[model samples]
Target: MSDGTGAPVLLRTDGRAAHLVLNRPRALNALNHEMVLRLGEALTVWESDPAVETVVLTGAGERGLCAGGDIRVVHADARDGDGSASAAFWRDEYRLNARIARYPKPYVAVMDGIVMGGGVGVSAHGDVRIVTERSVIAMPETGIGFVPDVGGTHLLSRAPGELGTHLALTGARIGAADALLCGLADHYIPSAALPDLLADLAALPVADAVARHARPAPGGDLAAAREWIDACYRADTVEEIVRRLLDHGDPAAKEAAETLLAKSPTAVKATLAAMRRARALGSLEAVLDQEYRSSLAGLGTHDLVEGIRAQVVDKDRAPRWSPATLAEVTDADVERYFARLGARELGLAGETGEPGAPGAAD
Candidate 1:
């Protein structure tokens, strides 16, 4: 039975599996507050439903599962309105990410294509994550002058070697194999096999359904490049990291250096700090709390609005970052992003001190 509510998200049940479909194909299923609330409600219901043995998440369109949150709203609020609305939305959305992380039933995520930012939040944390040949996963918030949120810092911090740092500062996209190597996804199932696999999920156990479709992802760039990625990104500061990348003699490393130069200096610096702190914070909830602070801090910056204007609004492809270069981003500037939100805190990590993924060797 399908929950035909004519909403941006669609809910349905088939055999023992319940599906949560992101339905806004026109916006590439960019999640809004309403969809987040609906998803939370659906998950709450299905968590206790005796017949639902598996919960599957998929996007409605051919493009991908989800792009991310509705950032246009964030851009608007930051530009014209008080920051409260954006903060409220993030509060609920981050809570949903934590819920999905701890969801007890088999939570299966179909990560087929174009998943980034909030999309990574909803899918990467699931117990059963399936990526396809078409899958392109990233945490690309820095490009728009926002640090990665929704436990993205936590996930990225746990990737192999300095892979997390490399991705955090550069906003690099990875394919299925790299996603697997970085621990962002569990299996690689071809796009062609997805329909049949989804149908099998309706009647079979998640492990069984996935096993029938899973295959080795043939190509990945990260493993071969780990030496330079780890060495270059391990520096204490972004500027030092850039110098290493430029001097490393690999064309790819130089390209990464150029990529870093192009991002908002403030955002890239804050992200590096966030990723490092996330490694020590010791849990997803803690990292999310930190990211929330970074996000709200971003609301007060000129670069956040300007970066969005250049990249998304005006389509100019050239963002004039405040403070301009990595050298101008001071320690105080980066530290301010980690300031406490106090009463506005997400508070997901009650009593704190849960374990984190051990620091990857850099």
Candidate 2:
């Protein structure tokens, strides 16, 4: 479908750089199924085209690269229809995420604005992820009663120490430096220099073009809080983690505890589970398969519907999560999210059975 300017995703080639501009700026370039299909189709074509040396992804407006998936649609689907549409969207979207990770050519993501949820899926997996001072990246699904999907768990679970756990539970937004420290972004480019950088990409090799504009990232908050973050978030359970956070005597830690408490209880618990499982799942593809299970499971739950209504539809900012409190979210409740899906599986990992396989407001 058109986002007025063109397809939701606009594809073009300038010199050697193939560009995919996410066109839904009115919604901060929010991704829908049509955009996902367009992206996959473009990549498939570019992979075979001799002229396309690199794929560059950027969002249309100043707000950000992408706010996330077209979640308003997902909310409507869950509320008004059987979830097959949402499920199909995710199936293709996750495949596209994996494709970017494993893309034969260099894939550059211009993450200059708000990159969250599904936005992170598309960008962070790329060969080159460029973040600017304007970037605010997050994986905030827990707040809306959803588990992180599109390989988010794989990326977060692999982040140093307990930082990923902290991020997953709190649904926090991090800046460029924090993103780099967390292993989310590769290069830093000033937003002002982006126009010049794009011009260089058309003529120069990907690395050379990026190096011309990339600079050392400025420092950010996550580094200073690492000691407490590592110590408090190392717990085996979400309850224990919150207990540690509250008792740590650090105001930041206490605030984190409050944030965790405020999110959807079941989502928080299940997200914690997803992060931990993602670490042991061996490869990115395996973790994505696991995430598919978790995503579909969350799709069928009460909290998912209510959380969206409160956060998006009603704009209340107060989600009344089912099971209410973390204590009420039982082990079984969280485990249900990881249950297998058999024939409905994403099967990306299983396609080649190979290793070396490849979120924020995310």
Candidate 3:
């Protein structure tokens, strides 16, 4: 079916296996409202279909599985001071994230290339996450003056050591091996072999098909830098983390410090808090509820607009962040992001309170 943007997200079935391809190669298969809705609808149908025992998700071209949600649309909504569209998109996208996390049937995702922001949301929660040498995974919302959403708080909260904190704060891109080490990806298969792997998946058991093609991912920088990452990111706040990184006097630490300094101070602080709070939450639904609140709060801020303008629209690579420094982002400001929305709250569990069910508010 068409993803409502002329680009079609092709869906096909072969015996007990179903394949869903994100089909906007030119745009790197970036998700739009129609794609999100269609994907959720498809998953809901396939979940109960006895003929569909497994689902394989991938992007159409070699560029990537998905770059992210159509942020340009978000930029327009926020610019026009009408967030209705943005809110609707996020609500449905987040629900899809919850459904993927709870999917009963085996769900395999081929994170072959660039996967960032909303792309990470879709693939990271799958039952089997396969990355390749070309895979470049990151949660880059902070760079756009937004904290990681789409249940990113929960995913990052569970990463090994303080690597989650490091990733959330710096928006660092990681390779296949690092993805495996951080629990983000399960297997590493070469991109070329993906076609054969998909063929096997259609003909064999899910586990056996994957086992036949999965191979060891090459070593990456994250493993060697884990000690430093934990050391620098374990601090109580973004400022303290920067201090630790600077004091370490190493190239990686210095680069990380600069990256953190470049993001919106409010986003950095709020994301740090979200990751910490998510650690205590027991469910993905709870994490998404918190994210919904945070996203609304972000929409109320000026930094998101400026950040997107500078980074995506203008390509200036320089954003004039309000409350430019971490010191200027008061604790109260950060706390406001986590506040419950009362009547406007997101309901991932639906009216029946069944998690991953389809009756949620849009």
| TM-score of each prediction | 0.96, 0.97, 0.95
Task: Go through the candidates in order and give each one's C-alpha lDDT.
Answer: 0.90, 0.90, 0.88
Q: How many clashes (backbone N, Cα, C below 3 Å) per candidate? A: 0, 10, 0
**Clash pairs for candidate 2:** 64-114, 116-360, 116-361, 116-362, 117-362, 138-359, 138-360, 138-361, 139-359, 139-360
lDDT of 2 at 45: 96
Give the per-residue Cα lDDT of candidate 3 at 353.
62
lDDT of 2 by residue, 1-362 (tens): 45577778888999999999999999999899999999999999999999999899999978999999988899988889899999999999998998899999999999998999999999999999999999999999998999999889999988889898889888899999989988899999999999999999999999999999999887889999999999999899989998999999999999999989999999999998888878877678888877888889998999999988888889999887889998898999988897766678777667757442221000
Q: Report the alpha-carbon TM-score of model 2 versus the true structure.
A: 0.97
Q: After superposition, how far is residue 360 of candidate 2 from its true place, in Å?
A: 30
Candidate 3 regions off by >4 Å?
1-7, 349-362
Worst 10 residues of 2 by lDDT: 353-362
- What tens digits encode model 3's per-residue C-alpha lDDT throughout 91-137? 99998998898899999999999999899999999999999999999
Clashing pairs in 1: none
RMSD of each: 3.7, 3.5, 3.2
